[model samples]
Target: MQNGSSLSIAERGCFHTDKFDDDGKIKRTGTWKSATAHIITAVIGSGVLSLSWCFAQLGWIAGTVTLVLFSIITMFNTILLTDCYRSPDPVTGTRNYTYMDAVKSNLGTFQYKLCGIAQYGVLTGITIGYTTTTAISMAAIKKSNCFHKHGHNADCHAHNNSFMLIFAIIQIILSQLPNFHKLSLLSAVAAIMSFTYSFIGIGLSTAKIIGEGIGNTSLTGIPIGKDFTGMEKMWKTFSALGDIAFAYSFCFILIEIQDTLKSSPPENKQMKIATATGIMASTVFYMLCGVLGYAAFGNDAPGNFLTGFGFYDPFWLIDIANICIVVHLLGAYQVLSQPFFGFVETWSKEKWPQNKLVTREFSMWGFDVNMLRFVSRTTYVIVTTIIAMIFPFFNEFVGLLGAGTFWPLSVYFPIEMYISQAKIRKYSFTWIWMQILSVACLMVSLVAAVGSTHGLITSLQKFKPFQSVS
Candidate 1:
C-alpha cells in the first residue's frame, strides 16, 4: 500500500509489480511529472474561448458563482474516479485500465454500455466541436482575399473554410500514422498557449476594470426604478451566472483526463493537483474577462468574445485569441482521437507496416490491420467536417454541444461510477451527502444544458435558421 510497494494478493496475483507503464502496461512505472503535465493538458482547451460568451449571458456575479460551483463538483468527481483505481486488477494492473472496465466490473453489461455511450458520445462531440473551433480560428487568423468583404476588414470566412478542409485532410492522413508519442510535445505546447492567452486576457480585463469603473455610458440614461445604483449594478453583475454554469457544464473534457490518469507514471495525486490549479486559473480568467468585456462593450460583446477591451484595435486580440484557441483545439482533438482510434484498432486487431496498430505487420495471417484506421480516419474527417459546418450556423451550437455531451459525462457519470462501486458505503453520512450533492449538481448542470440549448435554438431562429452563413 506504500509508495512502490510490491505485494501479491490472491485476487490480483497477476499485477504484483511496482514497475509499470502509464496505461497499466507491464513496463516501467510512470513518474509524477508526466502525470502533472498530462493533467494540465487535459484541463486546458477552447473552453476559455467560450467563457466570455457565458459571462455575457450570466453576468459577472453569477458567472463567478457558477465557475466556483462547477469546479468543486468536477474536482469531486475526479477524486472519486481516481479513488476507484485503488484496487488494481492483476491483469491490466493499475496504470492503464479505463473507466469502461471499472464500470463493467460494478454494473452489468447494459449499464456499462450506456455509460460507454455517454463517455464516447461526449468525447466525440467535444473532439468535433474543438476541431470546428480550430478551423474557425485558423481561418480567422489566415484571412483570404476571397472571403474578405471589405478592403480594410479582411474576410476570413473563405480562408477558414479552406483551412478547415485541409486540416481535416491532414488529420485523417496523420491518424493513419501510429506514432502517438509525437503528440506529447504538441499537447504541452497547446496547454501553455491556451493558458497564456487565457491568463493574458484576464490580466488585460482586470487592468481595464480597475482603471475605468464598471458603469457603462450606454446604460447611463436607462432607469432602474426604485433600485439603488449599487443594487442595479449588482443585478447587472450577476446576470451572467447562467452562462457560466453553461460553460462549466461543457468542461466534461474526456481524452486529456484519460491520458493524464493513464500515463506510464500514473500519479493520481499529482494529476488532481494540476487539474485543480488549471480549473482555478480558468475561473479567475473567466471572471476577469467577463467583468472587463462587459464594461468595455456594454452588452454588445461577441458571443465567443475573449479579448476586446481597452484596445485601439481589438482585432489583434481576437486574432491572438483565435491562434491560441486553434492550438488548444488541436491538442484536444489529438488527445480525444487517440483512445477512440486505439479502441477501434484493438477491436479490429489492426497491424500495418507504417502503423503497427492498423496495418498488416504480419502477412502470414493475411490480416490487414491498418485498413480500419484508414477508413475510420477518413470517415471521421469527412463526417465531422460536414457536421461542423452545418452546426456552426446555430448561435452557440458548439457551446451547447459541450453542455449536452459533457455535463452528464463529467459530472453524473463519475458519481454513478462511485455509487455503483460502493467503496464509500462504510461512511454512511459521507455517502448520503455525496448522493445529495451529486444529484444537486447534476440537476443544475442538466438544466443549464437544456436551457442553453433552447437559447441557441431561439437565437438561431433570429439569425439564419437552417441555413449556412456563407
Candidate 2:
C-alpha cells in the first residue's frame, strides 16, 4: 500500500476529490450546532464525574489553575488542528478528513504511522474506559438500591461483571449504526445527558453542603505549607493535572467532527467558534461539579461523585443520574469506537481492494447487513468489554491512558503539525513557544502516566479477576 509520502503529487491531487458534489462544493451534512453538540458529547464523559476527587488531590487553588490552563491549551490545540483540516494543497483541492490523514499530509509516512498508533491506542483506551464506567454506573445504581433496601448485606452485591456484559451487549447492537455522521442525533442526546447529570450532581452537592455545614466535612489534601513534603504535594498536583487533562483531551475526533459541518467560506473559523463554545460550556459544568462535589464531601470525595453519594435520601434522583450516565456511555462507546471501526474497515479495503470483503452483504431478520462491519465492530466492543471486566478500575485506567497519550496526540502532534504546516523556523518565537508547550505537557503527562500505571499495577496485584469494583 502506498503510504502518505509514497503517494506522488498526482495521487495526492485525487485525494478526497469524490467528497465534492457536482457543483464542485464539498457535500455538507451537519450544522455548527450539531458540531458543537458532538464536541460536547466527546469532551464530557466519565471524566467529569472524577473531577471532585481530582480537586481533592490538587486542592482548590491548584486544581482550578490546572483546569483553566488545560482548557486553554486544549482549545489552542483544537484551533490548530481545524486549521490543518481544510488547508488545501497547492495543486489538489483535497481536504484531510482524519487525524492520521492530516499528519500524513503535513509530516510524512513515518510520523503518520506514529500518530496512528497513539490515536488508535487512545481511542481504544477511551472505549474501554466508557465500558468500565457504564458497568460501574449500573453497578452503583444496583448497589445503592440494594443497600437502601437490604441494609449493606454482602449477599445483595450485584454481579458487576454482569452489568458490564449487559452494557457491552447493548453496545454491540448500537455499533451496527453505519457511520459517525449518522450518529449526530445520538451525539446531541449524549450532550443533553451530560448537562443533565452535571446539573443534578451540582445541585446535590449544594444541597449536601447546606444540610451539613462545610466545617463538619472531612476534606482531603494538604493546604500549601501545612505539614506535607513538597514531593508529596507535587505528586498529588501532577496526578490531578492528568485527570483534568484527560477530561479535556478530545483532539482525536476534532477533524472528524469538523468534516461533518457544512462547508462554507469561513470554514475553519466556524469550527473554532463551535469548539470554543463547547469547551467553555463544558468548563463551566466541570467547575460546578468539581467545586461543589468537593465542598460537599471534602477529603472524603470518591473518585466518582455519584458513587460517593451512595443511596442518599433523594434516591430517585440519584437513580436518574446513574441511568443517564449509562445511556450516555452507550452512545459514548460508539462515538469513540466508530473511528476504530473506520480504521479497521479502511485497512481491510486497502488490503483486499477487489476481494469484496467489507462490502459483502447478507440478510439478518430481513435487514441487510455488512458482515465485515458486524464482525469487526462486535469484536472491538467485546474486547473492550472483557478488559473492563478484568481490570474495572475506571478512574485509574482513565488517568493512565490520558497521561500516557495526551502529550503525544493532544499536545505534541498538533503543535508539530502546525509548525510544519506554517513552516515556522527553528527557535522562532512561535516555534519555541509551541515546543515549550509540548515539552511541558509531555513532562506532566509522563509523571502522571507513571504514577497512575504504578498505582494500577499495585491494585491489579491485589485485585481478583472478575471481582466487583465496589
Candidate 3:
C-alpha cells in the first residue's frame, strides 16, 4: 500500500499513519509555503471594500481606535488558541481541525454544535452579502449617465446588470471545482488585487489631505450639509461607524483565523506565522483605505463605500471596486466552503447511512421524499440564492448580519477555545479576562447588527422608491 494512504482512526480513537511506501520506504517532505498563502487569503475578503462606509459611520479617530483594539485582541486570542490546541489525542494531532472540532474538544460537544450552526449561518450570510454587494454595484454602474444610451438603449444597461449577476454565479461555480490547490492560488491573486486598490486609495487620500491642510480653518469655509451640523450629530455618526468597524474587523479576522489555523499542521509554527501576517496585513490595508477614502469623499460618501469617492468618476471607480470585490469574494467562497464541505463529508459518512433506510421508507404524506437525498445540495443552492436575492432590498441590514455573526467567530470563539484548552483547565484570571473580552466583542456585534437592521427597516418604510440611488 502507498504511504499515508492506509492511515485511519484506531480502536483507541487515535489516528495511525501508514509510514511505508509501496517499497516499504518513507516518502519525502512537502513544502508548506503555499499553505501559508492560503491562510492570508482566507482572512482578507469582501469586507475590506466597505471599510470607508464603516469609517464614515464611526468617524476617523473613533474608527481607528476600534480597529486597533479589535486587532490587538484578535492577535492575543489567536496565539493562545494555537498554543492550547496541543491535546495528546492522535486523531486530533493533525493541524487542520475545523473550528467545530476545536470547540468540541475544548469547550464540550454542546457548545461545539452551537458554534457549528452559527458558523454555518455566518458563512451563508457572507455569501449572500457578497452577492448583494455585487448586484448593487452593478446597478449603480449601469444607472450612471456616463453610460450613454440613446432611447431604448437604456434598457441595455438593465440587461447587462442581470448578466453581471449570472456572471457572479458562474464565477462561484468555477471556484467550487475539484482542484483544491486553486484556492491558495486564487487567494494570492486576491491579495494582489486588494493591494492595488489600497495603494490607489492611499495616493488619492494623501493628495486630498495635502490640498485641505490641517485644522478647523480649512473646515470652516466649506459648505457642509445641513443634516451634518451639530457636534452631537457628528458623535452619533462616529459611533455608528465604530459599530461598522467592529463588524468588519470581527468578521475578517475570525473566518481567516479559524480556516487557516485549523488547517495548519497542529504543532507547526509556519502556518501560524502566515495566518498572523495575513490578519495584520489586512488590518493595515483597512486603516489605509479608511484614511484615504475619507480624505477623497468626506463624510457623506455613498452606500457602496469604496466607489463613492467624489474626486473620481463614480462609474470607473465602481467598476474597478466591483472587480476587486468579485476577486475577494472568490477567496471568501473557498474558505467558507471548506468547513461547509467538511461538515457534509463528516455528516454523510457518520450519520447519513443510519438514516438512509428510514428516510426512504417514511414518506411525507403520499410523496416519496427519498427524492430528498439531494437535500443537502438543494438546500445550499436555494438558501444561498434566496438570501442573495432578498438581501439587496436592505443592504445595511445584511452588512450588520455579516458583522454580528462574524465577530463571534473572530473575537470570541478563538479566545474561548484557548481558555477551555489551557493546561490548568480550571478557572483563572486569564480565563476571566478572555471571557470579559469575548463578551464585549459579542455585545459590540449585537449592537451593530441591531442598529444597522433598524436603520435599514426605517429607511425602507419611509420610501419605496426604485430608480433612486440610496
RMSD of each: 7.1, 4.3, 7.2
Best by lDDT: 2
Q: State which candidate has the highest TM-score.
A: 2
Model 1 spans > 4 angstroms off? 1-32, 86-96, 142-160, 177-182, 203-266, 307-318, 350-359, 362-369, 393-395, 420-422, 459-470
Q: How much does candidate 2 score in TM-score?
A: 0.90
lDDT scores in order: 0.54, 0.79, 0.53
lDDT tens digits by residue: candidate 1, 334-370: 6666656666666555233244444444333453335
TM-scores for all candidates?
Answer: 0.75, 0.90, 0.74
* Cand. 2 Cα-lDDT: 0.79
Clashing pairs in 3: 57-241, 58-238, 58-241, 58-242, 95-266, 96-262, 96-263, 254-410
Residue 201 error, candidate 1, Å: 2.8
Question: Compared with the true structure, what per-residue lDDT tens digits does model 2 show for residues 114-196?
Answer: 99899899999888888878887887787767767767654555678888889988988988887787899899899899889
Report the lDDT of model 2 for residue 367: 67
lDDT of 3: 0.53
Reference-based lDDT, residue 377, model 3: 41
Any idea how many clashes model 1 has? 29
Evaluated at residue 265, the lDDT of candidate 2 is 45
